[model samples]
Target: MPSYLEFFAGGGMVRAGLGGRWKCQFANDFDPLKVQVYADNWGEKEILEDDIHKVEAEDLGRRADLAWASFPCQDLSTAGNGLGLGQANGGDRTRSGTFWAFIDLMKELKATGRLPRIVVLENVVGLLTINGGEEFKAVVAALDRLGMRAGAVVVDARHFVPQSRQRVFIIAVSKTAKIADALVRDEPHPTWHPDPLVRAVHKLSGKCREQWMWLNLGAAPELKKTLNKIVKSNPVGVDWHPPAETKRLVGMMSDENRKKLAEAKSSGKRVVGTLSLRMRPSNGRTIQRTEVCFRGLAGCLRTPKGGGSRPRVIVVKGASVRTRLLAPAEAAALMGLKSKYRLPDVYEHAFKVIGDGVAVPVVSFLRGKLLTPLLRSIKKSRAADDSKARRVARGSSERKRRGQLELRV
Candidate 1:
């Protein structure tokens, strides 16, 4: 029943997950490539392919019933652009700026008495730690300035997808109506102390590391996934293996570094400490092995770099496995996108799209568990207001009738 505008609408993942039930009024993204991919699947609605900073809420014609934003996570992601939240990194200029743009739009709506009832925002888990936590406080402060109360939760894609992508979701609701006290608990907010292992993972954004830490990876690592299950078993008839030189170089790391790598590989542990590799400095290759601590879940899929040297699943000989990369479709599934949802691009591009998306099930779960309940409360409060107005009108008319009767007497 809610009408919405999805901002930073990459791959339309948010729309796909929420569109089945909600009425989408508008959506937009800056990337033309992503726009093309979105059109191929969703059939081209009112999607604005412009910088959100340049687009005002009023430009969209009307305020929607709900506003959704899955803004750029590059500034907050350790694995991403790593542009810490600040003015210099275009943190306040690019996608990070989109958050303010959305807020500005909300403010514009408030000016016109048309603010949406609900707002849901999603981002990389690193938002909780970016800029040493000041960036996070700034975000919350912005919401507070708008007279909204927000709640956040870190959701894992593995809950729905085959992969272990995790994201932080912030749901904000205007505090004008009196909501049930039970619905708003006074729980202590989470503090910001960067997890050391997570810091390492961010340095290696190939996978979502925070999730690995939460699982007590030492005790329970990600379950191993065979390349065959993740990729088309016979992709282009190419048996992906490191070149002999690359293999030899990896095997020649410093003795100490080599020992740590071997130990981590054998125990299926995520290597938190950095290691030195034995490759040409220009090649920028590492002998690092994929942390298989928790094989039950797959690491977050990244957009395959067109470069053939992009990382691959390795099947160490005599160790019972073959290594290769997963096709984009499989990566999409890891992001909790339905298998049938077709990507309009080749494998690598599709992987990029999927990697830069919200896990479908994570959003769906939040919609059901958090957003829906807040919406229902808003509905009930509106009904109560309407009912109270009717009673007041009736009471005034009855009082007038009694006055007339007294006059007649």
Candidate 2:
């Protein structure tokens, strides 16, 4: 089995996507809550619950086939302060600087001839435009300097799951590896990158562009899954919003949203459920806004701070109208995490874990189409070399035996 390393490994979401074939050689994360959840599921033996900068790559005991970093998105996301890479804004900026530390480790490993064959990084799509897209280009250039063909694509979870999360996946392959192009040179990939990522990649400098890799996984133009399909229709014993709370949610709606709710009520349908709620400035006053989705999809999952960012599922069944936070299991389903995956005890922390994770099916798609095939090719080449070595050994042994016979005669 190919061994791997995961840095900033929150809740082991990457492992869930990579499946059981790849062994996690090392896991590192600083958050105790996330570490606990990861240990509960993947076990504590391999995980190192400490600051990643403090852990040396040499301490891993063996070279990993791959290394993945789903680094802290807090400094890179728009929902965040957006200090972004290479800025000096105190510890938050220093925290995002951890990416450079990861790069440093990659450099150290490469120097020691222990560099992983593949490296993958996941983060919010905001990284693409941060610092006028210089940060993204610098990252690709950094990987290129290490003699790896780096490629990036923005994948939306809505394509594989109910949530509308668009994250950026940057994959780097060793220069020695041979792999097929994901994106066609002259042709456009309408499904994979309708616009943004392809555009950004085109803008790469000639040298960096030369080191870019592409893999065509044949993603669909869109997905058929729905939010209602994954969410619970009848959640018993959970806190359902009372009439007073439900009235507040309804009264907060704008005229257009109110009309939509009225229309849904008059349509003779017994049930209608809305996915999200937002607080926006209306006429200079902060007002709550909830737009019931007609599209059968939920808004992106976010860490529900006091700002009311966590989405609510407002259910209007028959004469009863109710609202409740999307259940933790529901959030897991939205991220394509399996039913059996263990979540944190506190729902708030659980939401943070789930919200920041990569969608499982998205990772699975890459694994099946890009990662698995690339690894297989490497293994096949190694196996051929080993067979040739064995044959050479056998021939030398036979010659030695013949020489002994001749001498005896």
RMSD of each: 8.1, 4.1
Error of 1 at 288 (Å): 6.2
Q: State the displacement of the C-alpha of residue 169, model 1, in Å, after optimal TM-score superposition.
A: 0.9
The CA root-mean-square deviation of candidate 2, after full C-alpha superposition on the true structure, stands at: 4.1
| Cα TM-score per model | 0.74, 0.87
Clashes of each: 11, 3
Per-residue C-alpha lDDT of model 2 across residues 205-303, encoded as one tens digit per residue? 898776666556565646877765765767632577778888888887888887777766665554436546777789889876876765567787877
Off by over 4 Å in 2: 87-93, 181-188, 221-224, 270-272, 284-286, 381-409
lDDT of 2: 0.77
For candidate 1, the per-residue lDDT at 141 reads 61
User: On a 0 to 100 scale, what is the lDDT of residue 158 in model 2?
Assistant: 81
- Cα lDDT, all candidates: 0.62, 0.77
